[model samples]
Target: MRIALGERASGGSARDQVYLALREAIISAELEPGRRLSENELAELLGVSRTPVREALVRLRDERLVAIVPQLGTFVTLISTEGVADAAFVREALECAAIRLAAQRAGEDALAELQANLAAQDRAQAAGDAEAFDGLDEALHRSLCELSGHEIAWDLSRRANGHLDRVRRLSLPEPGYLGEMVAEHRQVVAAVAAGDPDRAEEALRHHLRMVLSGLGHIRAAHPDFFEEPAD
Candidate 1:
């Protein structure tokens, strides 16, 4: 079901609103992989016109979250293991470098922000709010990139990280995973706060490795959700 964008008096552009809503739905898995997205249905459901829905779908396609097939329709892109693995590798390298740079340059305020984000994640996890926790996870990583003063790298990392997020969410249903993730974040925070670049990088790498391992289990559990590797 689509969430309503408030009253018509706001004068907000429908295309932008539709774009944001569809992006969130796809990222949160509300729109399942390979599910067909009908422009007419979406426009009707969202109280917008087909023009805005079409624009939103095109943007989603650019983001690789939706695919347009000739003579068929747009479908939510399937999560591919190879895609996840490649994205994970890129994220790990960028994030590890980010953490190390953060350790070298982050001040007390920046460190505190990171700590607070992790605390919020913990609260979200305890409340059984995986979606909220996921948002905070993105914030924390992005904050690390910002701390490095690398806006270009941060922007690139953000896109790559979106791809990795699909695999990351797959692990949330596993038993005891939340607690383990909390501990992992704590260790990374501590390392950054200690101003130990090497240690921070190590911690970041460890966290990425853990995420990759979790993705392995997800792959095993839902083979159909992923694309087969090219022969």
Candidate 2:
């Protein structure tokens, strides 16, 4: 599959830029699961040398977003159910713990910011702006993690989220999915606003697990995007 590479952003090393670009393409399914990758072609497309392209692929390999096969070539990895579950587990653990701390510490202004984000999510959903909703979704989660005074919760969760994100991107087109997500976010935000740590954690946990609930449906809809069962 052909992909139009976006222009390089200002700042950051070429390797980091290339890594972010390739990683985004993979997560967005622009590169696509199991698509063959050519280092030379990628380098040419990105207007960089093969060195940065190879380095970026190595990083993606570490993230399990791509695999390098000997005597064959590099190809995007098929979505792994095991990988998705692992990511969910990590995300739930970190974010649940973070939400508890956030509930205890969040001030009115912080809560208002979160509520505003939810409002933005609603507007994005109403406008049929999936990309906008996606960003607001991320912003809401990051705000919760930051409120815990440990932003690394989000960083770690995101690093482990490549496969899970593909499933999320695919699920976006499902009817009422965005509305359901906004309602769940309201529950979590309400709990946090009430300063009830236990309730907040529970609500957030439920919301996070809800993401996994759609996985089976998504895999069925895009069977070719996932890994085949082992013999």
- Which candidate number would show the highest TM-score if scored against the true structure? 2
Off by over 4 Å in 2: 1-11
lDDT of 1 at 123: 94
| Cα lDDT listed for each candidate | 0.79, 0.90
Instruction: Report model 1's TM-score to 2 decimal places.
Output: 0.87
Q: Lowest summed-lDDT stretch of 10 residues in model 2?
A: 1-10
Task: Please give the lDDT score for candidate 1.
Answer: 0.79
Model 1 over residues 1-231: C-alpha lDDT tens digits? Answer: 754553321356778788877776776577878889898888887888899889988887876778999999899988876767777788888888787888899898988898889889889889988767777877787888888888666677656655567777777767888788888888988988999999999988998788777776887886766677679
Clashing pairs in 2: none
lDDT of 2 by residue, 90-117 (tens): 9999999999999999998999999899
**Residue 119 lDDT, candidate 1, scale 0-100:** 83
Model 1: runs farther than 4 Å from truth? 3-16
On the 0 to 100 scale, the lDDT of residue 120 in model 2 is 96
